[model samples]
Target: MSQNKKQKGKFKQKLTDKYRLVVLNEDTFEERFSLKLSRLNVFVLGGFFSIVLMGLTFSVVAFTPIKNYIPGYSSTILKANAINATLKADSLKVQLAILENYTKALRPVLTGELAPEEIDSLVLQQERRIIDESRLNATKEDSLFREMVELSDRFPLVSNMESNVKLVFFAPVSGQISQEFDPSVKHYAVDILANIGAPVKAIADGTVIFSGWTTETGYVLILKHSNNFISVYKHNGNLLKEASDLVQSGEAIASVGSTGKLTTGPHLHFELWSDGYAVDPVKYIDFK
Candidate 1:
């Protein structure tokens, strides 16, 4: 107990021991500044200055953009912006994939690499829309027939009418012409005999207006081009282009096959119309 008490007294004595700190002018030997402090005082002052410096550094980092450089520290606005940008990029990727699929479907048509016609008739049933009306009464039928006759006379099926506007055309297929446009028998199109799975291309850049099957013409595709021109493709094994899709000239739209009741074999029935009138496709395209 006496030794411990003596040690304690010595420690206290060291802490309370005062020292004078003085600054003097070098040449004049005049005192400029002086301070009276103990070792305990010096330690406390140094610790206080260190704490103040640390607090100042923390304030600058927390209140300024410098905090962004630190790990795991981010502003709310910056984080939200990054998230939004990421979502937008993901959406764009999805859209790009759809476009790629759309373009890929047309490549085989242009390249004539077609799959076999083993697809079921129901494969595209969901895209088909058929409308059939029952026959009217005799009196009503006569009236309708008379109206149709008058309209036909006014329009008078004309063949090989020259287009007033100059337009470039892309050949839809490379095949032998089996049939020619003969409007007298109401055959307003040409037929080209091709391989069973040959690709059928578009004659011009256009938006698909119709893509579906019909009893008379199976798997028909119709595109509405510029300058009031419309192109029709019928009796296809399958249609690659869908309605409302924008297609470029020479792009594949379908595969040739015998799909309609009127078809004799795998062939493409192509028709070109100008201003609601059927024109000879041979006049515009060279599908040899």
Candidate 2:
């Protein structure tokens, strides 16, 4: 026990031993400065300085923009830009999907490859598939509200139902109807005789989904409106709008012409479709 105590005393003495740090002038042999320090004091001062340096480094990295320059760190601006890019990409994907569906639905109309009956069935099947895929379930209150609205607007001039608002169509052209809509004979459109180069207007506000020339229809312009309504203008001498263009109601979108092979003279072949089934344009529009 005595030997251990003596060893402890010697260790303590070594830690408490003083040392002098001196700076001297070489030529004059004069001490310019001196500092007295013990071993324990030197160790404490070194550790304190090291801790202070670490804290300063941490503050600079954590609180200042300099952290962006360090490895494995990203700038706030870069993060925001990445988020915006992702959102835009998602939006573009949705638009591309809508365009693709429009093209697919209009393909048979443009090509005349499918019968009208077959097209109607195809559209019905697509609608059924969409309904089946949707997982939304309306409450009883919602169903009752919808039924009330439908009943109230059953015979109104301007129906304002959500998702199925009744649209008021404008006269596409002032002319006499030469041929009426007769589905029994597979004639789903009306032929209106008009003067050549007369302005052909849009029936409603919509986006031009198709504007191109076909061998059977000549310059055909198709517009997609709200509530799943589509209007097709055929045998136009010239198209004033292009695909993806927005047109207002009664806006001149084409010129009257009997340019198609099926046309007999200067006239306009106008067709209206609702939820993919061809409807009589005369029921909703008065050309005169």
Candidate 3:
């Protein structure tokens, strides 16, 4: 009886194993299909999957670092500056065009043939007034738009006088130099002593850039000249030129006295700078 039962169980197991199925293409065909995959087939398929996965990981790693190449040509600061400067230059061109038209219109009126004396008087007066207006507009525009256009270009200059390019001393007034131009430590000034007053002359032809008193350099006078250079006269008893005043070489600019914090006595401290660098005044000056 036990053997008969065992034979029946074996027959059931065989039937169950033979009739098992899987569907790979249920939509395409209704025809029935069967497969008997062994352990070796499963192992081969798993190895292929592992190889494909490794290839995918390698590809991802290789391409990741190469994505950042295009925008690295110029720095962010440069790009922004280029954009802003271009816009400003365009605006300036428009402004310049308007100015040019006004000048052109005036040119014809000035060149009209009135009598020499009549034309001279009228043209001179009109030109002077127009020049004054242009100058005022230039000042206003400079104050309003300097920072925006510093990198764009220099203002177009038209003047009767030559450029202020030198500043020197008048009759030698005796004074002890309290401060001298020292290149090693970046101090650029010659401080001279006087009793109450001494004449300060323009070292070069230049427009008065600044003439005022500060906490450090009191009663200062800064002159901007050609060759991208500036001459500074500091610690003055009196300042003669206002800001934007044109000055000639050897023109009186100030008086000698102590008015700033770094004063040893009542003296004049003079300096020369080029392109924001304080150069040795002795190189371009003769104390005698």
Candidate 4:
């Protein structure tokens, strides 16, 4: 038998015996190509495309976001939170009212006027509520935006809910009884205890004859109904309607608060007038 032996080469042998050589554009070439882009190009192209977008914002003029308001969806949630807070605040006010009635210095806003300092405090609180509502509304908007983003990968219906009037109430927010309607002393309204910023409602459908702030009443709303009936709302934290505005019955007219001479804790002094005389609200509407 003939014996065969391996021959040594002039070059060094590779330790990796299974190694294979590779070259670009070669028949058997196999390698991953990679590249790193500059930051400027990536920023300008990848991230800046959303900057020049035209739609709701970035325009010279803007429409009210009321178009985007999801009606009872976001605002309801906000109002619910606000109402709960208002209720708790009213509980505190209930405690304060007992002390307030005894303290002549407390000043009745219904029959009197508030000073500049008091008005400033009220305005600040209103602004704070508006801000909180805005923030909460923004959160809802953000959530809607995220949903839109997810839907962008496919197709989806409208992302917001609609607003339609459902029920009509004789009042707005809930509260406690303070004073009963009295025609003898000309106390024509029923007082309900509430924290400053609680809402007030119209007793019936009518046009708003007056809506403004006064020294005697921090805020006031008067509705003129048919059959010579007039509804007056006083000591509001804020007003929803303006003079000569048409409003529906059960529509929110204002927020409950103590701003008038007759007020102690935050409460709504609701009055009904018929043929130039004070009447009781309890006669027509059922309590909530």
For candidate 4, write residues 1-288 as lDDT tens digits.
122222232112222123333345466565545444444455567555666565425353234445335454345557799999999999999989888776755465544676768867886665432212233355777899987786776543432311112222366556777788754454667887877776677766789999888888678888898778788888898888999999877677788778877678788888776677565677655545
Per residue, candidate 3 scores C-alpha lDDT tens digits across 97-170 of: 99999988678667874456875787666543211223335576577686566435465332212342223423
Candidate 2 lDDT over 1-288, as tens digits, reads 999999999999999999999999999979999999999998999999999999999999999988988998888789999999999999999999999999997897889988899878987676542222134467899999978886876574344443243467888998899999876576889999999999999988999999999998899999999889999999999999999999999899999998878778899999998887787788788788
Higher-scoring candidate on lDDT, 1 or 2: 2
RMSD of candidate 1 to the truth, in angstroms, is: 19.6
Q: Number of backbone collisions per candidate, in order?
A: 0, 0, 13, 14
Structural similarity to truth (TM-score) of each candidate: 0.43, 0.47, 0.40, 0.40
RMSD of each: 19.6, 13.5, 20.7, 29.2
Badly placed stretches (over 4 Å) of model 1 are: 1-166
Ten-residue region with minimum lDDT total, candidate 4 = 159-168
* Model 1, C-alpha of 254: deviation from truth (Å): 0.7
CA deviation > 4 Å runs, candidate 3: 1-176
Candidates ranked, most accurate by lDDT first? 2, 1, 3, 4
- Candidate 2's TM-score: 0.47
Best by lDDT: 2
What is candidate 3's local distance difference test score?
0.69
For model 1 the TM-score comes to 0.43
User: Which parts of model 4 have CA positions greater than 4 angstroms off?
Assistant: 1-169
